[model samples]
Target: MTARHVLLLGPLLMLLGAAYLLPFLGVMRWSVTLPEPGFGQYHAALSDPLVLGVIWRTVRICAVVTVIAVAAAYALTLIWVRGGRTARTLVELCIMIPFWISVLTRAFGWLALLSNKGIINGWLQSLGFLSEPLTLVRNEFGVVVGMVHFLIPFAAFPLATAMRSVDERVLLAARGMGASRTRIFWQIFLPMTKNGVLGAALLVFVFALGFFVTPAILGGGRSVMVAELIYLRIFQSPDWGLGAAISVILMVTVGLLLGVMMRQNRGAAR
Candidate 1:
Protein backbone atom coordinates (compact mmCIF):
# COMPACT_ATOMS: atom_id res chain seq x y z
CA MET A 1 0.00 0.00 0.00
CA THR A 2 2.98 2.34 0.60
CA ALA A 3 6.70 2.61 -0.20
CA ARG A 4 7.58 1.44 3.30
CA HIS A 5 5.41 -1.64 2.89
CA VAL A 6 6.90 -2.41 -0.54
CA LEU A 7 10.42 -2.00 0.82
CA LEU A 8 9.67 -4.39 3.68
CA LEU A 9 8.02 -7.01 1.42
CA GLY A 10 10.62 -6.94 -1.36
CA PRO A 11 13.24 -9.00 0.46
CA LEU A 12 10.78 -11.71 1.51
CA LEU A 13 9.27 -11.89 -1.96
CA MET A 14 12.69 -12.18 -3.57
CA LEU A 15 13.76 -14.86 -1.11
CA LEU A 16 10.61 -16.88 -1.82
CA GLY A 17 11.07 -16.52 -5.55
CA ALA A 18 14.69 -17.66 -5.39
CA ALA A 19 14.31 -20.40 -2.81
CA TYR A 20 10.92 -21.93 -3.69
CA LEU A 21 9.53 -20.72 -6.96
CA LEU A 22 12.73 -21.27 -9.00
CA PRO A 23 13.13 -24.87 -7.87
CA PHE A 24 9.50 -25.63 -8.78
CA LEU A 25 10.14 -24.01 -12.15
CA GLY A 26 13.17 -26.23 -12.62
CA VAL A 27 11.06 -29.31 -11.98
CA MET A 28 8.49 -28.14 -14.49
CA ARG A 29 11.26 -27.59 -17.00
CA TRP A 30 12.73 -31.03 -16.40
CA SER A 31 9.37 -32.67 -17.04
CA VAL A 32 9.64 -31.52 -20.65
CA THR A 33 13.39 -31.36 -21.23
CA LEU A 34 14.63 -34.76 -20.12
CA PRO A 35 14.71 -37.48 -22.84
CA GLU A 36 13.82 -34.96 -25.53
CA PRO A 37 10.79 -32.68 -25.35
CA GLY A 38 7.01 -33.00 -25.73
CA PHE A 39 4.37 -34.85 -23.64
CA GLY A 40 5.55 -38.42 -24.25
CA GLN A 41 6.33 -38.97 -20.57
CA TYR A 42 2.87 -37.86 -19.50
CA HIS A 43 1.33 -40.07 -22.17
CA ALA A 44 3.30 -43.02 -20.80
CA ALA A 45 2.25 -42.17 -17.24
CA LEU A 46 -1.44 -42.23 -18.16
CA SER A 47 -1.32 -45.04 -20.70
CA ASP A 48 0.92 -47.56 -18.96
CA PRO A 49 -1.08 -50.12 -17.08
CA LEU A 50 1.59 -50.34 -14.41
CA VAL A 51 1.37 -46.63 -13.70
CA LEU A 52 -2.41 -46.67 -13.83
CA GLY A 53 -2.50 -49.64 -11.43
CA VAL A 54 -0.23 -47.86 -8.99
CA ILE A 55 -2.43 -44.76 -9.05
CA TRP A 56 -5.55 -46.88 -8.55
CA ARG A 57 -3.94 -48.75 -5.67
CA THR A 58 -2.95 -45.48 -4.07
CA VAL A 59 -6.51 -44.19 -4.32
CA ARG A 60 -7.93 -47.37 -2.83
CA ILE A 61 -5.46 -47.49 0.07
CA CYS A 62 -5.95 -43.80 0.84
CA ALA A 63 -9.73 -44.20 0.81
CA VAL A 64 -9.60 -47.07 3.30
CA VAL A 65 -7.14 -45.22 5.53
CA THR A 66 -9.23 -42.04 5.46
CA VAL A 67 -12.42 -43.88 6.41
CA ILE A 68 -10.80 -45.70 9.33
CA ALA A 69 -8.93 -42.60 10.50
CA VAL A 70 -12.05 -40.42 10.43
CA ALA A 71 -14.14 -43.01 12.28
CA ALA A 72 -11.49 -43.51 14.96
CA ALA A 73 -10.95 -39.78 15.29
CA TYR A 74 -14.69 -39.27 15.66
CA ALA A 75 -14.78 -41.72 18.56
CA LEU A 76 -11.73 -40.09 20.15
CA THR A 77 -13.27 -36.66 19.74
CA LEU A 78 -16.41 -37.88 21.42
CA ILE A 79 -14.42 -39.11 24.39
CA TRP A 80 -12.44 -35.91 24.61
CA VAL A 81 -15.64 -33.90 24.50
CA ARG A 82 -17.76 -35.96 26.89
CA GLY A 83 -15.44 -38.03 29.05
CA GLY A 84 -13.87 -37.08 32.42
CA ARG A 85 -10.47 -35.48 32.97
CA THR A 86 -8.65 -38.79 33.32
CA ALA A 87 -10.19 -40.09 30.13
CA ARG A 88 -9.33 -36.88 28.35
CA THR A 89 -5.75 -37.12 29.57
CA LEU A 90 -5.49 -40.67 28.22
CA VAL A 91 -6.83 -39.61 24.85
CA GLU A 92 -4.46 -36.66 24.77
CA LEU A 93 -1.55 -38.95 25.55
CA CYS A 94 -2.53 -41.33 22.74
CA ILE A 95 -2.65 -38.45 20.25
CA MET A 96 0.47 -36.70 21.54
CA ILE A 97 2.77 -39.67 22.06
CA PRO A 98 2.86 -40.76 18.42
CA PHE A 99 3.07 -37.16 17.21
CA TRP A 100 6.58 -37.00 18.68
CA ILE A 101 7.82 -40.29 17.19
CA SER A 102 9.53 -40.45 13.80
CA VAL A 103 7.66 -41.99 10.85
CA LEU A 104 10.53 -44.37 10.07
CA THR A 105 10.63 -45.56 13.64
CA ARG A 106 6.90 -46.12 13.62
CA ALA A 107 7.08 -48.10 10.35
CA PHE A 108 9.89 -50.35 11.60
CA GLY A 109 8.03 -50.83 14.85
CA TRP A 110 5.01 -52.04 12.90
CA LEU A 111 7.26 -54.30 10.87
CA ALA A 112 8.61 -55.89 14.02
CA LEU A 113 5.12 -56.42 15.37
CA LEU A 114 3.51 -57.69 12.18
CA SER A 115 6.12 -60.08 10.85
CA ASN A 116 5.45 -63.82 10.92
CA LYS A 117 7.56 -64.42 14.03
CA GLY A 118 6.72 -61.06 15.50
CA ILE A 119 5.29 -60.38 18.96
CA ILE A 120 1.65 -60.56 17.92
CA ASN A 121 2.05 -63.90 16.21
CA GLY A 122 4.02 -65.26 19.14
CA TRP A 123 1.32 -64.21 21.54
CA LEU A 124 -1.41 -65.67 19.38
CA GLN A 125 0.46 -68.95 18.96
CA SER A 126 1.15 -69.20 22.68
CA LEU A 127 -2.53 -68.69 23.42
CA GLY A 128 -3.53 -71.31 20.78
CA PHE A 129 -5.71 -68.76 19.03
CA LEU A 130 -4.20 -69.61 15.65
CA SER A 131 -2.80 -72.85 14.29
CA GLU A 132 -0.22 -70.91 12.26
CA PRO A 133 1.03 -67.38 11.99
CA LEU A 134 -1.01 -65.14 9.72
CA THR A 135 0.58 -63.31 6.83
CA LEU A 136 0.42 -59.75 8.12
CA VAL A 137 3.42 -57.75 7.04
CA ARG A 138 4.76 -56.98 3.55
CA ASN A 139 1.27 -56.70 2.07
CA GLU A 140 -1.73 -54.46 1.73
CA PHE A 141 -2.93 -55.14 5.28
CA GLY A 142 0.39 -54.13 6.81
CA VAL A 143 0.65 -51.07 4.58
CA VAL A 144 -2.85 -49.96 5.49
CA VAL A 145 -2.21 -50.54 9.19
CA GLY A 146 0.98 -48.48 9.15
CA MET A 147 -0.72 -45.70 7.17
CA VAL A 148 -3.75 -45.59 9.46
CA HIS A 149 -1.46 -45.41 12.49
CA PHE A 150 0.33 -42.41 10.98
CA LEU A 151 -2.90 -40.64 9.92
CA ILE A 152 -5.02 -41.12 13.06
CA PRO A 153 -3.33 -38.17 14.76
CA PHE A 154 -3.97 -35.93 11.76
CA ALA A 155 -7.64 -36.84 11.93
CA ALA A 156 -8.02 -36.64 15.70
CA PHE A 157 -6.32 -33.28 16.24
CA PRO A 158 -8.53 -31.32 13.85
CA LEU A 159 -11.76 -32.98 15.02
CA ALA A 160 -10.80 -32.26 18.61
CA THR A 161 -10.34 -28.59 17.73
CA ALA A 162 -13.71 -28.56 15.99
CA MET A 163 -15.47 -30.33 18.87
CA ARG A 164 -14.03 -27.85 21.36
CA SER A 165 -15.11 -24.90 19.24
CA VAL A 166 -18.69 -26.21 19.26
CA ASP A 167 -20.87 -24.51 21.88
CA GLU A 168 -21.70 -26.80 24.78
CA ARG A 169 -24.88 -24.81 25.43
CA VAL A 170 -26.25 -26.30 22.21
CA LEU A 171 -25.89 -29.81 23.59
CA LEU A 172 -27.17 -28.80 27.03
CA ALA A 173 -30.25 -27.25 25.49
CA ALA A 174 -30.83 -30.40 23.50
CA ARG A 175 -30.54 -32.43 26.72
CA GLY A 176 -33.00 -30.13 28.50
CA MET A 177 -35.42 -30.71 25.67
CA GLY A 178 -35.22 -34.48 26.48
CA ALA A 179 -33.24 -35.43 23.38
CA SER A 180 -31.63 -38.87 23.62
CA ARG A 181 -27.85 -39.17 23.73
CA THR A 182 -27.77 -41.12 20.47
CA ARG A 183 -30.15 -38.66 18.84
CA ILE A 184 -28.19 -35.61 19.99
CA PHE A 185 -24.89 -37.05 18.84
CA TRP A 186 -26.20 -38.07 15.45
CA GLN A 187 -28.22 -34.93 14.78
CA ILE A 188 -26.41 -32.07 16.56
CA PHE A 189 -22.89 -33.21 17.32
CA LEU A 190 -22.33 -34.73 13.88
CA PRO A 191 -23.49 -31.63 12.04
CA MET A 192 -21.47 -29.34 14.28
CA THR A 193 -18.20 -31.22 13.67
CA LYS A 194 -18.82 -31.82 9.96
CA ASN A 195 -16.29 -29.25 8.79
CA GLY A 196 -13.50 -30.59 10.96
CA VAL A 197 -14.21 -34.22 10.11
CA LEU A 198 -14.30 -33.50 6.38
CA GLY A 199 -11.19 -31.35 6.65
CA ALA A 200 -9.33 -34.11 8.45
CA ALA A 201 -10.47 -36.72 5.95
CA LEU A 202 -9.22 -34.63 3.06
CA LEU A 203 -5.92 -33.91 4.83
CA VAL A 204 -5.34 -37.58 5.54
CA PHE A 205 -6.31 -38.63 2.04
CA VAL A 206 -3.95 -36.14 0.43
CA PHE A 207 -1.10 -37.13 2.74
CA ALA A 208 -1.77 -40.80 2.16
CA LEU A 209 -1.74 -40.33 -1.62
CA GLY A 210 1.88 -39.21 -1.53
CA PHE A 211 2.91 -41.55 1.27
CA PHE A 212 6.26 -43.29 0.64
CA VAL A 213 8.15 -44.44 3.68
CA THR A 214 5.67 -46.70 5.43
CA PRO A 215 4.42 -48.24 2.23
CA ALA A 216 7.94 -48.55 0.92
CA ILE A 217 9.19 -50.48 3.93
CA LEU A 218 5.99 -52.18 4.99
CA GLY A 219 4.68 -52.94 1.51
CA GLY A 220 7.98 -54.76 0.83
CA GLY A 221 8.14 -53.49 -2.76
CA ARG A 222 5.32 -55.84 -3.67
CA SER A 223 2.66 -53.20 -3.08
CA VAL A 224 4.32 -50.33 -4.86
CA MET A 225 2.37 -47.06 -4.92
CA VAL A 226 2.83 -44.10 -7.25
CA ALA A 227 5.41 -42.43 -5.01
CA GLU A 228 7.59 -45.51 -4.86
CA LEU A 229 7.22 -46.11 -8.57
CA ILE A 230 8.33 -42.54 -9.13
CA TYR A 231 11.28 -43.15 -6.86
CA LEU A 232 12.30 -46.18 -8.81
CA ARG A 233 11.93 -44.42 -12.11
CA ILE A 234 13.97 -41.42 -11.04
CA PHE A 235 16.70 -43.13 -9.07
CA GLN A 236 16.88 -46.77 -10.10
CA SER A 237 16.23 -46.26 -13.78
CA PRO A 238 17.39 -43.66 -16.32
CA ASP A 239 13.86 -42.42 -16.92
CA TRP A 240 13.84 -39.13 -15.09
CA GLY A 241 11.24 -37.83 -17.50
CA LEU A 242 8.63 -40.35 -16.41
CA GLY A 243 9.33 -39.56 -12.79
CA ALA A 244 9.03 -35.85 -13.46
CA ALA A 245 5.75 -36.37 -15.26
CA ILE A 246 4.30 -38.30 -12.33
CA SER A 247 5.67 -35.73 -9.91
CA VAL A 248 3.95 -32.97 -11.87
CA ILE A 249 0.70 -34.94 -11.79
CA LEU A 250 1.01 -35.43 -8.05
CA MET A 251 1.78 -31.77 -7.55
CA VAL A 252 -1.27 -30.79 -9.61
CA THR A 253 -3.49 -33.10 -7.55
CA VAL A 254 -2.20 -31.59 -4.30
CA GLY A 255 -2.61 -28.07 -5.70
CA LEU A 256 -6.23 -28.76 -6.64
CA LEU A 257 -6.98 -30.03 -3.13
CA LEU A 258 -5.31 -26.98 -1.61
CA GLY A 259 -7.41 -24.70 -3.83
CA VAL A 260 -10.58 -26.44 -2.67
CA MET A 261 -9.47 -26.14 0.94
CA MET A 262 -8.85 -22.40 0.51
CA ARG A 263 -12.29 -21.98 -1.04
CA GLN A 264 -13.89 -23.87 1.86
CA ASN A 265 -12.09 -21.73 4.41
CA ARG A 266 -13.16 -18.56 2.62
CA GLY A 267 -16.77 -19.72 2.61
CA ALA A 268 -16.59 -20.61 6.29
CA ALA A 269 -15.28 -17.14 7.08
CA ARG A 270 -18.06 -15.58 5.02
Candidate 2:
Protein backbone atom coordinates (compact mmCIF):
# COMPACT_ATOMS: atom_id res chain seq x y z
CA MET A 1 0.00 0.00 0.00
CA THR A 2 3.04 2.28 0.48
CA ALA A 3 5.60 3.35 -2.14
CA ARG A 4 8.53 1.46 -0.57
CA HIS A 5 6.53 -1.77 -0.31
CA VAL A 6 5.21 -1.31 -3.84
CA LEU A 7 8.78 -0.86 -5.10
CA LEU A 8 9.78 -4.03 -3.24
CA LEU A 9 7.22 -5.99 -5.25
CA GLY A 10 8.64 -4.78 -8.58
CA PRO A 11 11.39 -7.42 -8.81
CA LEU A 12 9.03 -10.26 -7.97
CA LEU A 13 6.39 -8.97 -10.35
CA MET A 14 8.96 -8.71 -13.12
CA LEU A 15 10.13 -12.25 -12.39
CA LEU A 16 6.58 -13.57 -12.54
CA GLY A 17 5.96 -11.74 -15.78
CA ALA A 18 9.14 -13.14 -17.25
CA ALA A 19 8.37 -16.64 -16.10
CA TYR A 20 4.66 -16.91 -16.93
CA LEU A 21 2.95 -13.83 -18.23
CA LEU A 22 5.49 -13.11 -20.94
CA PRO A 23 5.00 -16.47 -22.61
CA PHE A 24 1.22 -16.13 -22.37
CA LEU A 25 1.44 -12.70 -23.98
CA GLY A 26 3.56 -14.15 -26.75
CA VAL A 27 0.90 -16.76 -27.46
CA MET A 28 -1.75 -14.07 -27.56
CA ARG A 29 0.41 -12.09 -29.93
CA TRP A 30 0.86 -15.06 -32.22
CA SER A 31 -2.84 -15.81 -32.20
CA VAL A 32 -3.65 -12.35 -33.40
CA THR A 33 -0.74 -11.54 -35.66
CA LEU A 34 0.19 -14.79 -37.31
CA PRO A 35 -1.01 -15.77 -40.82
CA GLU A 36 -0.78 -12.15 -42.01
CA PRO A 37 -2.13 -10.20 -39.02
CA GLY A 38 -5.92 -10.28 -38.88
CA PHE A 39 -8.84 -12.01 -37.13
CA GLY A 40 -9.17 -14.25 -40.17
CA GLN A 41 -7.51 -17.27 -38.59
CA TYR A 42 -9.86 -17.18 -35.62
CA HIS A 43 -12.82 -16.97 -37.94
CA ALA A 44 -11.48 -19.85 -40.05
CA ALA A 45 -10.96 -22.13 -37.09
CA LEU A 46 -14.28 -21.16 -35.53
CA SER A 47 -16.22 -21.80 -38.71
CA ASP A 48 -14.62 -25.17 -39.33
CA PRO A 49 -17.01 -27.95 -38.31
CA LEU A 50 -14.20 -30.25 -37.24
CA VAL A 51 -12.73 -27.63 -34.94
CA LEU A 52 -16.16 -26.74 -33.51
CA GLY A 53 -16.89 -30.42 -32.96
CA VAL A 54 -13.60 -30.91 -31.17
CA ILE A 55 -14.35 -27.98 -28.85
CA TRP A 56 -17.84 -29.29 -28.10
CA ARG A 57 -16.51 -32.82 -27.60
CA THR A 58 -13.89 -31.53 -25.16
CA VAL A 59 -16.56 -29.69 -23.13
CA ARG A 60 -18.90 -32.68 -23.14
CA ILE A 61 -16.19 -35.10 -22.01
CA CYS A 62 -15.01 -32.82 -19.22
CA ALA A 63 -18.59 -32.28 -17.99
CA VAL A 64 -19.24 -36.01 -17.79
CA VAL A 65 -15.93 -36.58 -16.03
CA THR A 66 -16.68 -33.80 -13.52
CA VAL A 67 -20.07 -35.23 -12.66
CA ILE A 68 -18.69 -38.71 -12.15
CA ALA A 69 -15.75 -37.43 -10.13
CA VAL A 70 -17.95 -35.35 -7.82
CA ALA A 71 -20.42 -38.21 -7.23
CA ALA A 72 -17.63 -40.70 -6.57
CA ALA A 73 -15.83 -38.21 -4.34
CA TYR A 74 -19.00 -37.61 -2.32
CA ALA A 75 -19.49 -41.33 -1.69
CA LEU A 76 -15.80 -41.90 -0.95
CA THR A 77 -15.69 -38.97 1.47
CA LEU A 78 -18.75 -40.32 3.30
CA ILE A 79 -17.00 -43.64 3.78
CA TRP A 80 -13.84 -41.96 5.01
CA VAL A 81 -15.79 -39.75 7.38
CA ARG A 82 -17.98 -42.45 8.95
CA GLY A 83 -15.93 -45.63 8.61
CA GLY A 84 -13.33 -46.97 11.06
CA ARG A 85 -9.63 -46.09 11.06
CA THR A 86 -8.69 -48.99 8.80
CA ALA A 87 -11.16 -47.85 6.18
CA ARG A 88 -9.78 -44.31 6.31
CA THR A 89 -6.26 -45.66 5.93
CA LEU A 90 -7.32 -47.69 2.90
CA VAL A 91 -8.93 -44.65 1.28
CA GLU A 92 -5.85 -42.52 1.91
CA LEU A 93 -3.67 -45.20 0.38
CA CYS A 94 -5.86 -45.37 -2.70
CA ILE A 95 -5.59 -41.63 -3.19
CA MET A 96 -1.81 -41.62 -2.66
CA ILE A 97 -1.18 -44.50 -5.07
CA PRO A 98 -2.73 -42.59 -7.94
CA PHE A 99 -0.83 -39.47 -6.95
CA TRP A 100 2.46 -41.33 -7.27
CA ILE A 101 1.72 -42.77 -10.69
CA SER A 102 2.42 -40.49 -13.64
CA VAL A 103 -0.47 -39.66 -16.02
CA LEU A 104 1.09 -41.39 -19.03
CA THR A 105 1.76 -44.49 -16.98
CA ARG A 106 -1.88 -44.73 -15.95
CA ALA A 107 -3.02 -44.01 -19.50
CA PHE A 108 -0.93 -46.91 -20.78
CA GLY A 109 -2.39 -49.13 -18.08
CA TRP A 110 -5.86 -48.33 -19.39
CA LEU A 111 -4.68 -49.14 -22.88
CA ALA A 112 -3.75 -52.60 -21.65
CA LEU A 113 -7.06 -53.12 -19.86
CA LEU A 114 -9.29 -51.81 -22.66
CA SER A 115 -7.59 -53.06 -25.79
CA ASN A 116 -9.28 -55.67 -28.02
CA LYS A 117 -7.00 -58.35 -26.61
CA GLY A 118 -7.03 -56.69 -23.22
CA ILE A 119 -7.84 -58.21 -19.84
CA ILE A 120 -11.45 -57.04 -19.67
CA ASN A 121 -12.30 -58.43 -23.07
CA GLY A 122 -10.53 -61.68 -22.37
CA TRP A 123 -12.36 -62.15 -19.07
CA LEU A 124 -15.74 -61.26 -20.53
CA GLN A 125 -15.30 -63.67 -23.47
CA SER A 126 -14.21 -66.44 -21.12
CA LEU A 127 -17.39 -65.91 -19.10
CA GLY A 128 -19.56 -66.21 -22.26
CA PHE A 129 -20.72 -62.61 -21.97
CA LEU A 130 -19.85 -62.19 -25.63
CA SER A 131 -18.60 -64.49 -28.37
CA GLU A 132 -16.38 -61.74 -29.74
CA PRO A 133 -14.49 -58.96 -28.06
CA LEU A 134 -16.59 -55.82 -27.67
CA THR A 135 -15.03 -52.62 -28.91
CA LEU A 136 -13.75 -50.76 -25.88
CA VAL A 137 -10.41 -49.15 -26.58
CA ARG A 138 -9.72 -46.46 -29.19
CA ASN A 139 -13.13 -44.89 -28.55
CA GLU A 140 -15.00 -42.35 -26.41
CA PHE A 141 -15.89 -44.92 -23.75
CA GLY A 142 -12.24 -45.70 -23.07
CA VAL A 143 -11.38 -42.01 -22.98
CA VAL A 144 -14.16 -41.26 -20.47
CA VAL A 145 -13.08 -44.17 -18.30
CA GLY A 146 -9.49 -42.93 -18.19
CA MET A 147 -10.49 -39.29 -17.58
CA VAL A 148 -12.85 -40.24 -14.73
CA HIS A 149 -10.15 -42.36 -13.11
CA PHE A 150 -7.71 -39.44 -13.23
CA LEU A 151 -10.19 -36.90 -11.79
CA ILE A 152 -11.72 -38.93 -8.93
CA PRO A 153 -8.76 -38.49 -6.57
CA PHE A 154 -8.57 -34.76 -7.37
CA ALA A 155 -12.26 -34.38 -6.49
CA ALA A 156 -12.16 -36.60 -3.36
CA PHE A 157 -9.33 -35.21 -1.25
CA PRO A 158 -10.88 -31.78 -0.67
CA LEU A 159 -14.27 -33.29 0.14
CA ALA A 160 -12.64 -35.64 2.63
CA THR A 161 -11.07 -32.69 4.44
CA ALA A 162 -14.43 -30.91 4.50
CA MET A 163 -16.19 -34.03 5.77
CA ARG A 164 -13.71 -34.38 8.63
CA SER A 165 -14.59 -30.90 9.90
CA VAL A 166 -18.34 -31.66 10.06
CA ASP A 167 -19.68 -31.77 13.66
CA GLU A 168 -21.02 -35.15 14.76
CA ARG A 169 -23.39 -33.56 17.32
CA VAL A 170 -25.69 -32.43 14.52
CA LEU A 171 -25.90 -35.95 13.14
CA LEU A 172 -26.56 -37.41 16.60
CA ALA A 173 -29.39 -34.93 17.16
CA ALA A 174 -30.92 -35.89 13.81
CA ARG A 175 -30.71 -39.55 14.74
CA GLY A 176 -32.37 -38.85 18.12
CA MET A 177 -35.26 -37.42 16.13
CA GLY A 178 -35.35 -40.76 14.22
CA ALA A 179 -34.13 -39.56 10.86
CA SER A 180 -33.14 -42.40 8.50
CA ARG A 181 -29.53 -42.74 7.33
CA THR A 182 -30.37 -41.71 3.75
CA ARG A 183 -32.51 -38.80 4.84
CA ILE A 184 -29.88 -37.51 7.27
CA PHE A 185 -27.16 -37.70 4.64
CA TRP A 186 -29.30 -35.95 2.04
CA GLN A 187 -30.55 -33.21 4.34
CA ILE A 188 -27.59 -32.60 6.64
CA PHE A 189 -24.21 -34.14 5.87
CA LEU A 190 -24.29 -33.42 2.14
CA PRO A 191 -25.41 -29.82 2.44
CA MET A 192 -22.50 -29.19 4.78
CA THR A 193 -20.13 -30.59 2.13
CA LYS A 194 -21.46 -28.46 -0.76
CA ASN A 195 -18.63 -25.91 -0.80
CA GLY A 196 -15.96 -28.60 -0.96
CA VAL A 197 -17.85 -30.42 -3.72
CA LEU A 198 -18.13 -27.23 -5.80
CA GLY A 199 -14.43 -26.47 -5.42
CA ALA A 200 -13.45 -30.00 -6.37
CA ALA A 201 -15.74 -30.04 -9.39
CA LEU A 202 -14.28 -26.75 -10.63
CA LEU A 203 -10.71 -27.99 -10.22
CA VAL A 204 -11.37 -31.33 -11.88
CA PHE A 205 -13.34 -29.86 -14.75
CA VAL A 206 -10.62 -27.32 -15.60
CA PHE A 207 -7.85 -29.90 -15.37
CA ALA A 208 -9.90 -32.27 -17.47
CA LEU A 209 -10.14 -29.60 -20.21
CA GLY A 210 -6.37 -29.57 -20.65
CA PHE A 211 -5.97 -33.36 -20.52
CA PHE A 212 -3.75 -34.77 -23.29
CA VAL A 213 -2.48 -38.26 -22.54
CA THR A 214 -5.49 -40.35 -21.54
CA PRO A 215 -7.66 -39.14 -24.41
CA ALA A 216 -4.81 -39.61 -26.86
CA ILE A 217 -4.02 -43.18 -25.89
CA LEU A 218 -7.59 -44.25 -25.25
CA GLY A 219 -9.28 -42.36 -28.09
CA GLY A 220 -6.83 -43.37 -30.82
CA GLY A 221 -7.64 -40.12 -32.69
CA ARG A 222 -11.31 -40.97 -33.22
CA SER A 223 -12.49 -38.99 -30.21
CA VAL A 224 -10.30 -35.95 -30.61
CA MET A 225 -10.68 -33.22 -27.96
CA VAL A 226 -9.58 -29.59 -28.19
CA ALA A 227 -6.19 -30.18 -26.53
CA GLU A 228 -5.39 -32.95 -28.98
CA LEU A 229 -6.61 -30.77 -31.79
CA ILE A 230 -4.17 -28.06 -30.72
CA TYR A 231 -1.39 -30.64 -30.73
CA LEU A 232 -2.38 -31.72 -34.18
CA ARG A 233 -2.34 -28.19 -35.55
CA ILE A 234 1.10 -27.42 -34.20
CA PHE A 235 2.97 -30.72 -34.44
CA GLN A 236 1.18 -32.67 -37.12
CA SER A 237 0.13 -30.00 -39.55
CA PRO A 238 2.58 -27.17 -38.76
CA ASP A 239 -0.26 -24.66 -38.49
CA TRP A 240 1.25 -22.44 -35.86
CA GLY A 241 -1.22 -19.60 -36.27
CA LEU A 242 -4.26 -21.80 -35.91
CA GLY A 243 -2.74 -23.58 -32.92
CA ALA A 244 -1.95 -20.32 -31.18
CA ALA A 245 -5.41 -18.98 -31.91
CA ILE A 246 -7.01 -22.09 -30.43
CA SER A 247 -4.74 -21.86 -27.39
CA VAL A 248 -5.84 -18.28 -26.80
CA ILE A 249 -9.48 -19.31 -27.00
CA LEU A 250 -8.92 -22.13 -24.53
CA MET A 251 -7.13 -19.88 -22.03
CA VAL A 252 -9.79 -17.15 -22.29
CA THR A 253 -12.57 -19.69 -21.77
CA VAL A 254 -10.81 -21.09 -18.71
CA GLY A 255 -10.30 -17.61 -17.30
CA LEU A 256 -13.97 -16.76 -17.72
CA LEU A 257 -15.01 -20.00 -15.99
CA LEU A 258 -12.67 -19.35 -13.06
CA GLY A 259 -13.94 -15.77 -12.72
CA VAL A 260 -17.55 -16.98 -12.65
CA MET A 261 -16.82 -19.56 -9.95
CA MET A 262 -14.95 -17.04 -7.82
CA ARG A 263 -17.79 -14.53 -8.13
CA GLN A 264 -20.32 -17.19 -7.12
CA ASN A 265 -18.15 -18.18 -4.15
CA ARG A 266 -17.88 -14.57 -2.98
CA GLY A 267 -21.62 -14.08 -3.35
CA ALA A 268 -22.27 -17.18 -1.27
CA ALA A 269 -19.93 -15.90 1.44
CA ARG A 270 -21.73 -12.56 1.51
Candidate with maximal lDDT: 1
- The C-alpha local distance difference test score for the whole of candidate 2 amounts to 0.88
Query: What are the runs in model 1 whose C-alpha is more than 4 Å off?
Result: 1-19
Q: How well is each residue in 1-270 modelled by candidate 1, as lDDT tens digits?
A: 999999999999999999978987887787888898998888999999999999999999999999998999889877977799999899988888998999999999999999999999999999999889999988999999999999998888778878888889999999999999999989998898888887888889889989999999999998998899989999999689989899899989988987886776566556
- Model 1 TM-score relative to the real fold: 0.93
User: Candidate 2's residue-wise lDDT over 1-270, tens digit each?
Assistant: 999998999999999999989998998888888877988779978999989999999999999989988898788777777888999889878777899999999999999998999999999999999899988978889999999998888888778777877889999999999999999989998898787788788888889899998999999999999899999998999888899899989998889888876875675456
Provide the lDDT at 167 for model 2.
84
Could you give the C-alpha RMSD of every candidate to the true structure, in order shown?
A: 1.8, 2.2
TM-score of 2: 0.92
Q: Give residue 77's error in model 2 in angstroms.
A: 1.5
TM-score of each: 0.93, 0.92
| Candidate 2 error regions (>4 Å) | 1-15, 264-270
**How does each model score on lDDT?**
0.90, 0.88
